[model samples]
Target: MGDVLRRRRPSRAVAPLRRDPRASGRFQRSHRRLDLRQGCVGRRAALLRWALAEMQRAFLGVDCGTQSTKVVLRDPATAAVIAVGRAPHELIERDDGTREQDPAWWIDALRGAVRDAVRGERFDIGGIGVAGQQHGLVCLDRGDRPVRAAKLWNDTTTARECADLTRKLGGDRRVLELTGNLLLPGYTAPKIAWLASHEPEAYARTVRMCLPHDYLNLWLTGEFLTEAGDASGTAYFDVRARRWCEAVLAAIDATRDWTRALPRLAPPLSVVGMLRREAAESLGLEAGIPVSAGGGDNMCAAIGCDLVVEGPAAVSLGTSGTVFAYRAEPAVDPLGEAAAFCDSTGGWLPLAATLNCTSATEWVRELFAMDHAEVDAAMASGGAAGLAFLPYLSGERTPNRPEAAGVFVGVRPSHGRDAIVRAVVEGVTFGLAYALDALRRAGVAPTEVTLIGGGSASDAWAQLCADVFDLPVARPAIVEAAASGAARQAQWAVEQTRPSLAPVTSRRFEPRPRRDLREAADRMAALREMAGANRL
Candidate 1:
């Protein structure tokens, strides 16, 4: 990247290197080979004085989500992703509100993804970082083996345990004071309590408890460590204090020492450990390479979208919907409407999340026996008119109503398939709008909202975000914000420098706020408040 590394012109007497067609796009021994022997060292140095240039280096970013594991090879020099690989995980679901995945499945997927990405590429990988879905509990035995399947964020089996823990710690407001968020079923703390009661044997075997990303870090670096951003979602971590709250942990289980069981918290911007030999061999990486302490998916997305400062908010529309904004200090909502989370940048990230978005649309599509194209086309039609949907086919997180179900208001006998689809999409968008309002109430006034994730691909969804929130919704050129953020963190940790690549919107959706949107938001809230558990 400098003059010293630049190749010089060849002299008239010197012949250029020859290429072999049969080399399969690679260098052959005769065409270009360097012998590192002592005798050939001088000759090798002289031969390279006028021909080849330095190869660009890259970093690996791994995003381990609920449904899949995605890996990206990003070149920091160009701020571009060179290659990507993805592998899916099978979600294990039972009738009793249990959803899980084998921890081994994640490891296999991670290794396979690396192999898939680097199969034919030739570049130096400088470092590695991982961004994982928050709140999933991955328990390990004394031998570092998984004790059981990891309980996912949507698993509702721990609702009773969560309630019991909340009761022990005091009510909702008191719990918020202790943890900066509610003790919901989706959080890690409740899962631990669930294990202690329902699966006592497994609880006894779980010597170490870690979030999904922390487990990946352990496998990569042989270090049991976690960062503040991911740890904040555990429902036992104090966002303001930036540490685990002992009182909350005691409420979960007074008999156990959680400080010893939980992974040690690593500094947000630091490199927790180096890549170990075994993991390196498995992932085709160099041993002892630095691995940064990447944050949770939302925190990493903040970095990817350049939301490190307190300006624009980020909205991720994947299986779920989440809106997060950065702040200099913790924005603890007294009502627990927005989670007072910590970002990886040592700032606060006040986040409002919904448990439904694309998943809600998917449910409607399945019920109607329609495909993606059909749903997209239908959403392009006129709005649902007076109809409004709650879109809570599954329970919701934002309203703190785990018993809530889908509700449709003002549906007429003449409402057709197109209107139904419009209502579903609109309902999902409105839910996020309500969530964004929570952030605003907590003192985050974002200039705009950056849309990312799978749902951002839909023009209909992007336009709805703009219309619903009454703010410009921008979509970045990069699709994998979480993975991109992980790589950037790793790059910064190693080089102590980052490129001047701010987020640029490839497409911008300006606001055309509908009067009906306000009415719909009001109706949804009225339903949630009046009859969260009843159809009446």
Candidate 2:
């Protein structure tokens, strides 16, 4: 079978779920010339025209992902994406766990993306919502330009700083009490501390600090502001209070004037400001377009998955996997097992973020020198590895300490690369399931799962998730849910007063019987526990 056919041999339910005549015709017409593989979404007419007329007239959503920046023109009335555009981005790094990016490059990429998206279009793009890789700190000079490269979420250069912050803030208990999370090198506070102590001059010049998405919002509207969703990731914000905690700031003895450098907080859906004429001209957009206060990638992904209202949580497996459970009230973990934050939709989300996921799979594939063809072949051969692996190569993030790295135990020479590959896949799935368990413990038992991210492209991976999680995953008809999500946010932002602008379809995944699921779960639990014990 060809890759597409083999992968898309839809489940039995898919046949019955095929669109009725009217919807199918509309889809075909709206998406007439676009190919799915090349990121052709939002090209359909009813969807497109509705968006342009009602949504795109006022809002634009831009997502600055790890690999690309996607821009969408949306219609607020229908909450559809009229047009979409993307630009590439690269991650810089070193062996010492340093990953960074230039803030200027991010801006240029976004500008280029917006220009491409609206090149021939005539809609008046208004409120812009920017979403980007979370946990990255963008420090700025007094004039609001970057003083140095941003320290990304994946960068581990602040490990020592994380430890120092944990110690200074009265250990894990106190850290969780105040920040809703313990010190991790990936969060904002440790990065700030790392800069303050190591590069005082850069820190001194840093009049304000912003997360990656917030920084882009500043450039778009020339306003200093951020939403609660992004703010909670910074160790400085109090999850319970939903604002910056002065006590935490006092504990770190950060410069008394430091907080003033940051933008005033904006509600997630709040309209921050309109585009400046210069920004508009650079991006081929109209001046005075409204820009909504957007959110972190995870929050936006949840919105894309329709997890904003309620019901089963969504699982996003990109390079990293995040299991987000939404709640109307904040849920804190004093034990620091999960990271809880504010959702962009004025709710709380209990997040289980383990570094292991699609990244581990990619790393293992590369380590074995196996290309996409090899991985596909192995899966087609019913590849099953009796072996179990711990995919914490970059350290575990959720339900385990960030310092915990990946391990493949019980590797026998008899174990082939295929077995290793299967083990890696199962490992990440089980890790995510572990997070779901955490959510259940917190009294939010999800009834369904919305599977998303680039990793969702793989049939084998989705099947594995369904089997391991023992729950059907909702694979939406369209991919690029993040970009679509940003576009939807644009729709909502422009309307301002509308209720429930998101469109929904009845699509779902059902669990396939897997005899080995229970065994695999048991083994993964033992491995995680053993790893935890060794750390102490």
Candidate 3:
């Protein structure tokens, strides 16, 4: 019994490090006993020197989303990400069709992300910038303290207010003409109207209304400001003029008691302010570190995906789907087919955002009891699902129709989960194509679309984008393109100079022949037409 628990001891044992100066260090002592390890210390010291040089020029980028906040530390010279960290936060859904989160929760999550990113040691951390969820309204009092939880973009409580705005603003035509978008519940105007009518006290206390990214920027730098892309989402920004819309503000006054709610416009790449002392300490960063007023999540992602050039767009299939086409100048459709948002690159970008993309696929997958990989393979098989899906699991944004519900037409008993899943994927892709067609109708066709997001990770899905969009779709190896875009903004803020946009390394997926894609897309168009007619 004693032998069973006893451990065997070697004839000689070597301890690790010795602090005594008289005694040789562990490596040296061990080396003297073994001659082959002599030069390793010098080599390690040289590598450490190189590493420090690389770290000195690194920039920090943070992306705040609905579910989590991601912090990325990148090396500017090589454009390589050195450190990545994420902090998860909670999302609360009220029974009243309202979705919101404590503004403090986002702040705390951001702090934790930064702290975790720079833990254990000091980092140069040249600059810091944020790319956060857009269209979410955060009200702040005169003291710059949050008055209440942030009303997220998905919140449907503002639906009635949004409808009122469309009517008061002279229908969708006036909204598109002034704000470069159709009236939507996700915009700041509707949210403000809802608060003014329902939460009058809170609305009266509000001194300034800011987007999510702006709120984080305020905490980091004590500055109240917003980036161009985010400002564009507020339904009060003049895309061509690059300023706040005075007309929209006045229009709201007639319908809602929003006398105090207004947002100031700032360029997406504008330098907001330096990091505050408390923020600096928490992030393990030096005080006064440059913090750029980064743009909305999608716009920053466009920058991250390197979609600065005209023609080529970036397609993000996140919780929501978006096809963002970079333009050298402002582009607005009178028909309200697409939105003209301010790009982080200091220009205008026309965007078409679908309320749901991957979220739609996930719903169908769960409903059918099929895993992602299995469904993805079937979709890539190029077999027709004999079905068409509208992919409106939530609702619609671009094209400005929310009543458009998800549809699974042409379903038959022979079809299985694979066919249904393929239809969902194809349906979302077709929705994207519909937006692309709008871009083309406006006389601006994308040369290519850079696919970035969770959907792009799957080869089958990437091929599907290529097939459905009928153009080359590029994907990047970098997972956090949005965070990288923020890092790029930070790098520009601190460098005392701006760098020219250069194409970064990325993989391309050229369109391949697909007979089924055309058929599926045509079916989707017909279904969309029927749905549109039903709404009318």
Candidate 4:
């Protein structure tokens, strides 16, 4: 499996994600085509586009995350965030590892959030982009309406389906060769298989299966389309070749031609379609506005943080945590531990994900009846010694254990809510640290990591990331990196030029000298091993 990508490991050529097209234009001379940042005229022309972007049109980005739909409006030329609004989601969480949400909820949330962001001012909207949590299975009928609630990325109910698919496809090595990654229960292909097995009636009625963001695009433009970045997570995409894996589709259903129902793979920085009049009215935007080929949340965050040229890795501490680094070439984890995904900027994103992060913290907060302030205080109270947290509230992902649940180890009699919360934070950080080690083995070496997502809002958590990853951690001033990345992608699709954007960071946290949590990391690893093996 490693040999497939090892042949191309040592060389990569692509320009970095740009803050100023004048300084550096997005360039790629690789064998891969569809470079979003190709035709650059000159500094004067680029600067003129920048000025026009700010003055002529307002770009919109909609991010439908696990817990909310956040809308961000930006002046593309100036890269200044104009307005932001958010609306919460009601997840259908079950003890049986079932995580779902009604597809209608996303559009309704988008409607509310977009209306809030625009504040009914009706600015000249140029383009819109969508960044959504990936690997969700959204089944649709012949009329392009959802057949059932969308299964989310954190859902772990499809372990049996994942195993059956792998087994039928000649096991792990062959599966990896087909998909460029292992079949995790969190992925969409497994969910589709599960739907066929468990809900045969719904599956029979389902004429198509689209990802969460793809579904949003369908509602907006009445077209079925997906991009390489988000498609890579579906377990039916050839990440290396940037196409659909026919073998995986056959394994899912030999009877049906699943590829026919799959959305067209749109190129990066290209408009998937224009906004329909109904969607425009609902979103309070102008009709016929272009919609960019937006990507998965992590992919969008990579652009938002400017991680295109592989300077440093990115740690997105969202509902589920992810540690990823942008690579010019494919970053293949030979052991199949990390994901070999595609980036939004026509590059590769080698990534490792944990199923829990803020989800774990929020659970602990509710368990202890504490507010966000108290959670921050608990993060600051890290005096608890010999304690470890194993965050598996939504089951494990990187370790590929779907049945495991979260647990607190080494709790002493003196351990209070504050101490427990501290351990929880530490445990979540340790999980991401484990992922970072996997990336390191995959050749993703970096001196620092950029922080994004809701977890980055806490000062104590930023320090914890620096301490855990043992690298300098910086949080960009752009609070909603995914949404901002979406808007920026939309801007690029409209103008076909890189926006002059830079990371506006408020602070950078440096790891303390020899903070030394090796023992704790090992302890958590041991607990994870035991818990995953059902021994803890």
Q: How far off is residue 206 in model 2, in Å?
A: 1.2
Question: Model 3, 184-204: lDDT tens per residue?
Answer: 887788888899889999987
In model 4, state the lDDT of residue 143: 91
Report the number of the highest-lDDT candidate. 4
Query: What ranges in model 4 sit over 4 Å off?
Result: 1-56, 514-516
Inter-residue clash pairs, candidate 3:
none
Give the whole-model CA lDDT for all candidates, comma-separated.
Answer: 0.83, 0.74, 0.76, 0.84
Preferred candidate (lDDT higher): 2 or 3: 3
Return whichever of 3 and 4 wins on TM-score: 4
Which is the better candidate, 1 or 4, if ranked by lDDT?
4
lDDT by residue (tens digit), candidate 1, 488-513: 88988888875668766899999995
Order of candidates by lDDT, top first?
4, 1, 3, 2
- Candidate 1 runs further than 4 Å off: 1-54, 533-536
Model 4: how far residue 224 lies from native, Å: 1.0
What's each prediction's TM-score? Answer: 0.89, 0.84, 0.85, 0.88
Better of 1 and 3 by lDDT: 1
* Runs of candidate 3 exceeding 4 Å displacement: 1-55, 94-96, 254-264, 368-371, 500-506
Scanning candidate 3 in windows of ten residues, the lowest lDDT window is 8-17
lDDT of 2 at 161: 82
lDDT, candidate 1, at 246: 95
